[model samples]
Target: MFVPFLIMLREGLEAALIVSLIASYLKRTQRTQWFGAMWAGVFIAAGLCLALGIFINQTTGEFPQKQQELFEGIVAVIAVLILTYMVFWMRKVARNVKAELEDAVDQALQKGANSGWPLVLMVFLAVAREGLESVFFLLAAFTQDVGYAPPIGAMLGLATAVVLGALLYVGGVRLNLAKFFKWTSLFILFVAAGLAAGAIRAFHEAGLWNSFQAVAFDLSNVLSTQTVFGTLLEGILGYQEAPTVSEVAVYLIYLIPALLLFLMPARPAASATKDAREASSARR
Candidate 1:
């Protein structure tokens, strides 16, 4: 649950920041009249994303119970791959995102009416990237937990991000965005590891895997989901009362590397920030 919220929140903030940058630039250049078309494009892309999400949710419901587990297991695996890629990619490439975006804007403005399609394409691609990431993550998370909470988490995250983004734009708040992204990526790494393990367990249950299915341990006797701490663990980290050997193996295999990468040295976020600033300045 926390994973979904955090993932969506972070992604939403990225998108919000991009849109805000475009909007602000338009206003500054007295091309504010283009704002209406920009908003319309944004809304259209958003609506399409919403429809796509709904379609995915409803599609998952059509499978038989056990088959659903198998399908979910597969989807979770896909989610793991994509999520892991995103974490590392961002670590390596996030700094120049702002500058790359600014260059696109400059090119579009230079073209005038030809800019309309480019603007539409840029907004669609940015928001859709975020939306696609959210859709896959929710699919994976919802499969692990039994309930209505994942969707609730996503909505909460998106709403909260929007509020925070608006405040940042309106001079109502300030955040160390570099630190925010760095820390949150670490959090997401843990979540992805849990999904890796949980999905493996699901596949075993669905008859896809047969190795190392022994019951690793049972904690239900002492700690039940009915208990507060138990429920929190279950929601936050996919804790199970009686996890199988394969589940534990998959979880740790994913967790250990993810944790190491997150904790290990990488290029400083400040360096990325500096590079981005320099790039933006060069463009200007």
Candidate 2:
């Protein structure tokens, strides 16, 4: 539950940031008359995302056990890839996101007078990217277990993001977005590692992997998934009582270099400071 909550919170906040930037830019430029189109784009993207999620869920619901496992494995792999790319992509663009959005709006408005399609297209593409990413993540999360907690956690996280976005927009709160994203990205790396390990397990269950089925070690006697804490860990970190040797290997192989690269300190601290200041100024 906590894992899904955090995932949704981060993704939702990213989308919120984009939308807030667009809205704020429009207001500052005295082009607020197109707010309706902005909202319409958002709603359309959201609706499409929801529909796609529902379709995928329903389509997979009727699969046989083996096919279900295969599907889960596929979704997990896709989630890991997407999450990894998102982490790196955001790290590269976090400093210039606001400026880029403002520029996009400027270009859109300049295309033609009384032309709102550009704005709509821009918002739709931006929001839809986040929405589609969230859908994949939520699907991967739901594949792990059967419970109501995941959905509840996702809803609460999204609500919190909306509230935080509103606070930021109204100047009621301030945040160091750089620090927030840095920590969350670290956490997400671990989560992705877990998903990768789980994907290997799912493939084994689907009978796609026959070798390396040897149990690395069994901890079922000490802490079974049936236990409360074990269940929570399993949900958040893909804890396995008797994980396969391959699973452990895959987890470490992906996590080690990824962590090192992600945590690598910037070469020039001065430039980082300048970028941070620029980001702050853009936010203002």
Candidate 3:
């Protein structure tokens, strides 16, 4: 519950932040009239995302056990891919996001009298990117356990994001957007990696891929998914006892590289500040 909530909050706020940033930019430049269009894009994107989640849930509801397993495997792999991409992409773009957005808006409005669609396009693309990402993630998560928790988690996440987004716009909260994304991206990477392994497990169950089917270890004796500690591991880390060799391999393979990549400093300290300033200046 908490996990999904936090995910939604972070992702949701990120989207909200994008919308707010554009709105603020327009307001500053005496272009407030098109604000409604920006919002229309955002709301429409969000609705599409909701519809996507619903479709996944409803579609999987009728599958047999084997088909369900296959679906889970596919969804998990996709989740891992998207999450990993986000992790790397965030690291790469953290400093330049503001500049990029500002530039985009600038280019859009440069058309003068006919800049409305361009502005709307920028906001729409940004918001929809986040929305589609969230939708895929929710789909993967919903298939994992198939209950109220996933949706609840999503709602909680979005709710938290709303609060944070409001706070950010109001000029009260002090946020280090860089480090915040770093840590959360790292966490999300691991979660996605675990899901990736779980995906492998699901495929094995569905008899899709049969490579390295041996059990790495039997942790069931020490802990079961039903146990308190086990539940925590499962919820946060996507742990499964008696995981096959392929699962373990995929999980570790995904984690080590992702963690190292995430931890790798984007810039040396001596130059990072200067870069950040330059980037910020470009945006301003």
lDDT of the structure predicted as candidate 2: 0.88
Name the lDDT value of residue 184 in candidate 1: 86
Tell me the TM-score of model 1. 0.88
| Residue pairs with clashing backbones, model 2 | none
* Model 3 CA deviation exceeding 4 Å by range: 267-284
Which scores greater on lDDT, model 2 or model 3? 2
The order by descending TM-score is: 2, 3, 1
**Predicted structure with the largest TM-score when compared to the true one:** 2
Question: Ten-residue segment with the worst summed lDDT in candidate 2?
Answer: 266-275
Better of 1 and 3 by TM-score: 3
Candidate 1: where is the Cα deviation over 4 Å? Answer: 111-113, 268-279
lDDT of 3 by residue, 1-284 (tens): 65577677768878978877877777777878887778877887788877887877787789999998998888888778887887777677666666567667777767645657776676778888887777777777776666788787888789878888878877878788877887788789878987898888899889998999888999999899889989888888899878888989999998998888777767643455456556556655
The per-model lDDT (C-alpha) reads 0.79, 0.88, 0.79
In model 2, which regions exceed 4 Å deviation? 266-284
What's the true lDDT of residue 66 in model 1? 83
